[model samples]
Target: MQPYAQNWTHVTEFVMVGFAGVHEARLLFFTVFLTMYLFTLVENLAIILVVALNHRLHRPMYFFLTHLSCLEIWYTSVTVPKMLAGFIGVDGGKNISYTGCLSQLFIFTFLGATECFLLAAMAYDRYVAICMPLRYGALVSWGTCIRLAAACWLVGLLTPVLPIYLMSQLTFCGPNVIDHFFCDVSPLLALSCSDVTLKETTDFLVSLMVLLVSSTVISVSYGNIVWTLLHIRSAAERRKAFSTCAAHLTVVSLFYGTLFFMYVRTKVASSINFNKVVSVFYSIVTPMLNPLIYSLRNKEVKGALGRAFSLRSWKGQ
Candidate 1:
């Protein structure tokens, strides 16, 4: 790492040089990304509405699913709109104010961390439901669900404060260009003129703790779930139990796989283009697929969607 220059002028804004090599295809990229952003929003909104309006779907699992959908809406919003703006070259599109950049970084970190904990909570809910069928109600009552959800949000809210503060203290002297579409920790750290060893270590530790704790819960919960599923006498019952877990597991894999690759490292040494590509998967693509994954895989969500569409058709008549 280079030492901070003594005669450097402070940068008040950052130019996000997104996909600079592909500027000729801006329209094509804009169209595709915009379509994806809108689809993600609509899909997640549908999940929330479906879970809210259908009484039969009003259970702990759906409750958590609704929260997840809501988080996805905010999570995708943090980056995609700015990215879309950059694509079209509108509203100083690629240029973000220093404060705006930091704010984006904070909110993005908060929501991302919140989702990790929320996923863990959902896994625990499933464990209780499947591994302790008789006590599911008492174990995961409405009050308990609210408290668990609140705790997840609270922890997420706090997780990014220290890191953002540390990042805010770093100096950005000159050449204030970010190589990615969004102001992520790595890209931001890469642009810093100050020594970023502390920030990098903090970021790595924070990400490691969040991933380790959440993944542990998910792993243990699924382990127990698999064990219980094996003891079922009827093959139909086993399949049914496994089906419920499969969607959640798939989602966990998608969310964590990219995250581990993106944030767990101690240094910002990866190819910037590669980082951007990986970011798209978790930041844009995963959220869009989540609602589809749940709705397609879970019968209750599908039935609710069916009822919703039928009600709309009846109203049209």
Candidate 2:
């Protein structure tokens, strides 16, 4: 490693070469991304409607589900829309100005950090539901849920701006080319001409907290949930309990899988591409999938959605 001041002098605004050299496949890329974004929006909106109108779905599990859907939609929007625009090859490989880069970083970090907290809240909800059903309503009351939701949003919102400010202080005097697709912390850090000692440490520690700590909470919480479920005597109740958790499990796995893959980099560019692909999953595809996964497999959501839509149709008539 070189001296912090000396080596730092050689960095600037990153030029992101958009996904794959398949700039020629821009049309196909646009079609796929556009379809996915639409799915994300519609499916997440349907989830919100289902959770809102259905008495059964008004519980903590679905309440968090509604917010998670909302987060996913917004989270994906922070990056996917721009990436989709990049698909035209006109703006593809376009040099992102400093402000645009920071905005991307801020939104992405806010949503990503929010996700870490939200997933923890969701797991905690499951724990209460499965371990102490009678007490769950008391434990995860609407007030508690709102507090949790607000905390997720508030902390998520605050966490990124300081870093963005830190990043902003650095001067970009070198090659303006960013190696990856988006304005992620790591890639951005790699391009910074400043004292990144603190920045690098912050990214590593924060990423560790978000990814590892949250994963552990989900692990421990679910472990207890499984243990409690084993004690259920009624097979019907057991099946229902298992099914309720299935959607959350899917979402957690998908999000964690993609996130860890994206940041867990080595000294290889091959892994970078892998990270980008998984990044798309958490950033674009997973949120859209959440509503669909929950809705398709969940009887309550499906029922609620039907009722809400039917009511709407009746009003239209």
Candidate 3:
């Protein structure tokens, strides 16, 4: 072993310092997160089921919505259960093996990247629908939608491989304490004893590319959508057109807002506590809110949900 390597022992595991010094409210925190997790699962599953069973929703828009719901389910799952374990003090709720940490980081990064691209695709779908109604059917046909969705997944799957492999190769010698709830990229990067300039630069460049491209698409799509909506002569027709895009806009704002603050910033490790708070919004809160945002704002989704449950109710009776 090298002299520096010999000086310090390799870290086998890491302790996640999640909400440390909060022993007094562990139960309360556990209850809140548990409820949110379960609710997120139920809501996203309902969306998938409602969209699948209802033939009326067999369109490109609903197809993308179902993909989003499924992504949210897996996205939230990658981090929240481990967080809940910390709150409940399971094995002190903080210890994770090195392999486990990297696995979490890889999965989380992949899903997040996927959501960014998927949201952009959804925005483009809306733009085509509102801005070019005449050609929307041909432009966003099922084949096109399938291809777009597959590309999003493929890019997401590939984006994290380099960053995560770099992270796994990093030397975590002693002080294996992660200051965040889960093994996120920043926190893990902060804990590494190895020189992480290359890793940080690689991660930053990858993130910037994903965020810039995705956000640009979303912005341009919405810009045209807004322009088209403004040109409609009737106020009612304008409102109707705008409503279709509202839920998606809300979700995109919530998701991308936190992401921009967290990743595309000058100082990632400046404030650990604040980072945790912001992370909560995107990783935990946004998934829970997606179902509510879409279902509440969307008449079609609401109607489908009602019909789904009511049909079951009638069958039971």
The deviation in Å at residue 282 for candidate 2 is 1.6
Q: Better model by lDDT, 1 or 3?
A: 1
Give the candidates in order of TM-score, highest first: 1, 3, 2
Which residue segments of model 1 deviate by more than 4 Å? 1-6, 311-313
lDDT of 3: 0.91
- Measured with C-alpha atoms, the lDDT of residue 58 in candidate 2 is 69
- Model 3 residue runs over 4 Å out of place are 1-3, 311-313
Q: Model 1 clash pairs?
A: none
Clashing pairs in 2: 12-172, 14-178, 15-176, 15-177, 15-178
The segments of candidate 2 whose C-alpha lies over 4 angstroms from its true place after superposition are 1-14, 89-93, 264-270, 310-317
* Arranged by lDDT, best first: 1, 3, 2
* Residue-level error in angstroms, candidate 2, position 217: 2.4
lDDT of 1 by residue, 196-274 (tens): 9999999999999999999999999999998998899999999998889888999999999999999999977558889
Q: What is the C-alpha RMSD of each candidate to the true structure, in Å?
A: 1.6, 3.1, 1.8
**What is the C-alpha lDDT profile of model 2 across 1-317, one tens digit per residue?**
33565555544345776676676787998899889999988888878876776677767777788888888888888777777766775554356777888888988898888998899899999888888879987899999999999998898887777667777877676667776778877666666566687766666566766787778989999999888889989999989988978888888898888777665442224566666776777788788787888888888787777767786766965
